[model samples]
Target: MMTVFDRRSLLRTASISGRAALAAPGLLRAQALDEIRIDWATYNPVSMLLRDKGWLEQEFQGDGTRITWLQSAGSNKALEFLNASAIDFGWTAGSAALVARVNGNPVKAIHSFSRPEWTALVTRADTDIGTVADLKGKSVAVTRGTDPHVFLIRALADAGLTERDLTPVLL
Candidate 1:
């Protein structure tokens, strides 16, 4: 799926307790840093693709480098890891990148991932509710700062509705 990557803080947790500043395979190989720790957002396909596939480890296995993976529930958690220096790379959205920058996080974008929009709203099939227009004066649940919220905004705009039309339920 092609995904729009929103800006976000690097999801790397180099915490005192607990970080994919993600690099393409080519770049990763070229740098060959002493250690290769990739911080992936919670449980997602990218980590599965790399860890389950073993592609990243094998490439650096003989180069005296070790591969480590950090799992984060969300970009905010991932950014916590980055601040601690526990990881070298983090995975996050473009919106996250923007917020983190405003709050003072040092990071850079080195690659792009899915071009597809990864978030959407789903209602029960038998429900009378249908489109955003059906939501007038109703409540909508959304993740406050994430794409779910972004989707709600864009979707409402398409329906010629505004936040005034529906009460927001933040999750």
Candidate 2:
């Protein structure tokens, strides 16, 4: 004779399985928590704040996770770190992020950390070049393949011109 399982027994099994399913992702995350390396840049004051406070370290310490702070000289350095998998997270200018994506860097911009007006286009005081329009037909020194380059492009566009209109002296 076959023994029949009661409703309570089936309900108990289902409850236990449900509990295990609920706990699985947390356990997986705990196992995955080996280390996290994030960019630290004086340019990014929020990054400095996070690193100086040691908040991230404290939070992940109990899970045996290591936290590393790497200095980013600029958005270029941050992109390099992210591209090479040297860092899990890095801070970079929005334009740099766009460039990285366009070039198939396989990265994502996860945070809008700050709006600090960190960059500007300037000319020598003695120069007659006072505005974006003045840039036309002029030679401008720029680090090619960077945020400044993108900024220059935008400036040129705003002035109803393009790179073809200027002599871009790549540095």
- TM-scores vs. true structure, each candidate: 0.67, 0.68
Clashing pairs in 2: none
Total clashing residue pairs per candidate?
31, 0
In lDDT terms, which candidate is top?
Answer: 2
Deviation from native of the Cα of residue 37 in model 2, angstroms: 0.9
- The lowest-lDDT stretch of 10 consecutive residues in candidate 2 is 13-22
Question: Candidate 1's residue-wise lDDT over 2-55, tens digit each?
Answer: 433221211221211111333444344455567777786644555555566565
Give the worst 10-residue stretch by lDDT in candidate 1.
10-19
lDDT of each structure? 0.64, 0.73
lDDT of 2 by residue, 74-147 (tens): 88889999889898778888777887899888776544533435458898999999899998889988866776
TM-score of 2: 0.68
In candidate 1, position 43 carries an lDDT of: 42
